[model samples]
Target: MKTSFDTFISEFQQTDNPDEKYTLIEQIISSLAIIPYGHKNLTKSEMIAHKVFVILRDYVIINQLRQKHAEDTSSQKVLLNVSLLFMNLCNNINETNITVFKSLFIHKPLIDELANCLHEISTHGKYLNDPSRLRSVSSLLIALQKIRKHNFTALEYSLIAPILFSVTQCLCSSYALDMIKSLERNFIQELDEVQMLFLYAMPLYVKWYWDYCDPEYFVKILRILLNDFTAWFTSCQPESYLQRSSQIDAMIRHLNYFLVRPTEFDSMNIFSEEFYDDYCKLVLHWSSILSSILACSSCTMNVKLAARTSVQILYNLTLHLNVLNFMKTIPSFILMLLKVTDLDHDEVQLNAYRCLGKIMIEADIKTMTKPSKIAAVYIAFLKDTIDDSKKTERFYSLLESLKSKFLSIVFFYD
Candidate 1:
């Protein structure tokens, strides 16, 4: 009598016949571990294994709508099995630098079903959070990147966020293309107007840690997000949801990087304007983020850094423009930069003073009537700076000019 392994091979050879394909694969997979290798040469039997994996992957998609996979051989259970099976198959094929993954996964269009199968796997939060299972997903994404649109399938990360963010960050490293792919996927909502603009100027804020931790990889991903965000923001459909999303707020948080590394990105390559028109608008947005971020942190060191970075980006960019927004924005810009005093070290205070000086250079005290309460805060800060024993002569000098500007406008109203 022939063994079960022999029966599977006989059935597989008949695979060209559609009627026999499903049954042949089902029989082999149903008893995959049980097949006796008693004295058989397993290495020579790969053709049989490849055929089995291919059929199972296709089965889930063609039958996804089946009411029974929901209960009997549920799509849920089958999906979990497929995710695991695909990973193992890749590993098995990769034992010695083999191209089994490409041949089986990328070359075959139907295999994208694995990405969908993962959507079902993600539904069971308990299972997804399982250490072993989560690692399986990271592994799958990483391997997929080596082939094709693997990164394109990252929408699954958004579907499982809060945890997905934490997990992907945990999995991040120099070689983890999957984590980046997932991040790129999360930024895919370009059609949402507010989401797009905030996205433009966003990575500068929301992505600080990710960008600093691995700049080369992170920047590549960020640029992609920014390009998409900028395109969407410039299209100008004019939706009211602009205030609804934190995109603009998030951009303000990390405005420091742009100032310090202004040369890091080529303007023509990344931003649309050659000068500071949008950079000034960005300053306004960042000031809001810093104020929001500072309210949650009491550390003096942090407050100072946030303030200084805010001032620096605004100060430096404000100097480069020949545009007329200087008078339009100076009063509010100075007020925003003033709040960041706590984060500065000895040098930051000086750098910040220079930023104020740059803005003061273009002042028009005759225009931009800011509110009285807002003007009072600037007066109070200037007076306090003048009184401080630690004040650098240069800083105090810059303060005198700003104090003059503030009082010049305030008394005009008085």
Candidate 2:
């Protein structure tokens, strides 16, 4: 039986129309849909797969990057090539071909080279101020994102700075983040809540999967956004600035905006049956990180830092705490200061109560005069009450201490 290899190649070469090529590729892909398990032909499959991906990788703009370069936004060529190659490989092996796609990235020089190309995206955006090039860079980065299934490495972080600075400056992250979350809500199934959370960080998650994420990443961005808020507050009229603030009182307005919201999951529908059983265990590890931040917040004397950052400080503190979970930490954090290691009882009480007092109301005003005018005075008044009451008049002092706590609650809630 003579089989015509020319006939097969002829039909493929005839697909001159891009859409037709893609359609033919899809037909090839549909043939590869099967699940596999047990011992497998990884070596043979990997060898062919590597060659396929290597040929595909060749199409990846094979020039040493130069400064004035423009990023290629058209990934469909290589993307289609990989998809077609992947489907054929999968049909022969009886498994999804994601592992084969990943092997190309796992090869060291290739990873470094890919990262280097991405670095061009970063550099071009920064020095050139080319937003289109930046967008194209992101498109390529995102395709690698698909190949790696959104995974990354610590080394690629430098490549992110250009895109991050660009996107943060632009007004599109809000929309982009929401689109990512909507996809997470609908299609991201295999992940449990925790894996899903890593998935939810959107652009950031891409960095995280690659091991590029640092908790400080968010902290740095928060600081920049806070500065924007401060600058706007300083320049604009008081009523208008307050009304038009980007972050309310300098705290993250949406706690889980890019993370999981309550709707995509329910505690009753928790991904883990062990969640409730291990609730205390999870809190134990999380609280250690929380405690250190609260301590730093306590020791810092920068009044502007405290006044401006208080909302965010408390906002973060409350994050891991659902109503019940929140209550569990308070006793420890508060009671730590309340510790009777016999440090001056009155003095400790005065300091602890004072920290709690600021938790209620701290000035948001940028002007010195505003914090001093009754707004500042109200805060000082609470301090004085805590001080005097901690000393002599036991009955009056208790009453004053109670007053401060109640007053704080009123302002915080109102």
Candidate 3:
């Protein structure tokens, strides 16, 4: 079997005709797809699989490079086949063959090629419209995700930086947003697998390459997702739902990372006038969504979780004075936060109160139009603190502290 596979690979490499090469690759894929890794001929099968992987890796690297510089439509079918072959190999990997598979598939050059292929598909016009592009992307992402399930050395993490950057760039591209919209339109209330895989891959990449990734790119992608969420919330379709709770969770996770790494995110121009305006729009949309969700008596836990995350993101944004200033200008935003403070969820209420405190603490009472509303929210919270018999002593202490902190500002304004 080894000899036969070696001969096949040689024939594949020596072929000058693209058609012949494509046919040869398909044959190889078929042969490797059936290899019984659990059978008694495991050693022979492993040898054959290893040889085939080496050839496929080389083919992917070379063709990906070619596709990068030129619009090679003819190669698309072959690349798709190769990606599917990789996915098959990944699917068959187990503890016994893990080392062998990783050795063959975890090459840095091959990873770079995969990343470049995705980047090209996202940026190039012809590739964007190709019917097989999404499938190819999905296959590649599956294989990459499988490989990434194993632990990597520091050097390997360094090698995968290109992949992370490419994925981020692709996610932030206009093409990705358009593709998501198209999928939503076609599927109507379900996110496509390709979109979900992209979302899944993002946090893993961020986790592995946070130090290397640009904060601006993260912000750009987050803004795109927020806009999508806003649209889903405000769309005319009564049956349309915000089925992207996972997306909201992702946003919250990434925002939490940004908050902890203040040196990396807080010091940047992420809060410039342009970003501030974008965030203002996001907050207004989020406010409206939160108001609607609060009004619904039968809102699901997922929707409420999403609403809480939106407020958490808003609280994180308030760490910057510019955002706080903008929040103060929007009465709907203040009212939404105040309504959130009345929610039963402790974490949600904490974030809401934090947001309100931030916005009002630095607020100019002389220019403020809704100081009365802010005062009312604090007074209501105080009343709740006084009237609730189930409140613990510790809870009362925390509320009393918050009351002192907020009442001082209210009296100063009065």
lDDT of 1 at 252: 29
Better of 1 and 2 by lDDT: 1
Report the lDDT of model 2 for residue 68. 47
Off by over 4 Å in 2: 1-50, 62-96, 117-136, 144-202, 205-207, 210-213, 225-414
Q: Give me the runs in candidate 3 sitting further than 4 Å from their true place.
A: 1-106, 126-154, 168-210, 214-264, 332-335, 338-350, 360-414
Candidate 3 residue-wise lDDT, 52-100, digit = tens: 6677777653465446443566566666677776676576555566667
Higher-scoring candidate on TM-score, 2 or 3: 3
lDDT (C-alpha) at residue 180 in model 1: 24
Writing each residue's lDDT as its tens digit, candidate 1 over 1-414 gives 136556665667766874465556555555553434332423233542445555565554334422222434333444444554454444333233344445554432343333343444433322332333333343344334333222222443233233223322322222122222323222113223222212222223223223223344444443433333333333322222122224332432332343223332233233324423444455445455445645554555444554555455544444343422452454565554444433435444444444543454335434534436445555556666665433433345445445445455544665
Q: Candidate 1, which segments miss by more than 4 Å at Cα?
A: 1-224, 227-281, 292-299, 319-330, 338-344, 362-414
lDDT of each: 0.40, 0.35, 0.59
Best by lDDT, which number? 3
Task: Output the lDDT of residue 55, model 3.
Answer: 70
TM-score of 2: 0.31
After the best TM-score superposition of candidate 1, give how far the Cα of residue 343 lies from its true spot, in angstroms: 6.3
Better of 1 and 3 by TM-score: 3
